[model samples]
Target: MSKSVVPVNIADKLSQFSELWSQKKVAVLNDYEVKLAKLKGEFVWHTHEDTDELFLVISGRLTIQLRDADVVLEPGELYVVPRGVEHCPVADEETAILLLEPAGTINTGDAGGPMTKAAEILN
Candidate 1:
């Protein structure tokens, strides 16, 4: 069997940040990056005009509000918001999630508001 480069504990990385909506890169594969973030409350409404976003819930609840419908994700669940789709994510309580996307995807996508965080931060 092939061995992993190393084990990454999602919970351990999640504990490295206390602020909500901040993401930390945990791993990389080719052109994609694996990230972990702590989320709560509603994120800014935005769209990745050039790329899609994948959200995997590690714990707690995540509600992705889409233009036409809302998707609720639970632990072990995942959702991919297609490119150019405007959506908002809200967490009634603190939630932990993993994201898979192109290496340079900004957290706020096209919004780029004050909440937009640099994508290079790693754990």
Candidate 2:
């Protein structure tokens, strides 16, 4: 039998991954990965074919642009974009965010542009 321990400080776990765009994975269950991302500037417009993505602003503001709508999220705010919806993230300043999505979800989706990054998790 195997048992897992709950983390004491999510913020500390997040601090472990300081690299840009590299996610820090806190936990995984079935198909979902709980991750933390530190972001700045603009990310490529992309979409996932298999699952929706949830973005929660943890400590800074983030702006998300959908095909037709522009949403700004502040600390304690969250949004979910349905699968197959194209969207881009732009942060004028450094921001920290939490993400919930299916495992194997790509950051750039089907459109691998210049901004496409090979996903990596910080240990």
Candidate 3:
């Protein structure tokens, strides 16, 4: 197998889409997919039973609402939601984030609704 040596610009890939809550797969590492999403408003309360979900703020702010407390993240910050933990992501304004999860992990997790979107490769 041949792999090309290339760099993926996060800003460039983010510029390719404007739809909120939609995930764009930018790269893959091992079995995990590196994804980017433009988020606004609130996301569904969900839980990935078998895998932890990583949310890395690229721009703006994100609040992960947990039953006990809220985890607030700003640009350059990240938080890992443990498996089986229900969390709802809320953004007061337009925010860009990077998500790291296993391949084929559903955006909505256990809470499947209209907000759920299958991640598509940015390329």
Give the TM-score of each candidate: 0.92, 0.89, 0.98
As for TM-score, the candidate ahead, 1 or 3, is 3
Instruction: Note the Cα lDDT for every prediction shown.
Output: 0.89, 0.83, 0.96
lDDT of 3 by residue, 10-78 (tens): 999998999999999999999999999999999999999999999999999999999999999999999
- Cα error, residue 14 of model 2, in Å, equals 2.2
Top candidate, metric lDDT: 3
Candidate 1 residue pairs that clash: none
Put down candidate 2 lDDT per residue, 60-110, tens digits, no spaces: 789999989999999999999899889999888889998998887777887
lDDT of 2 at 110: 79
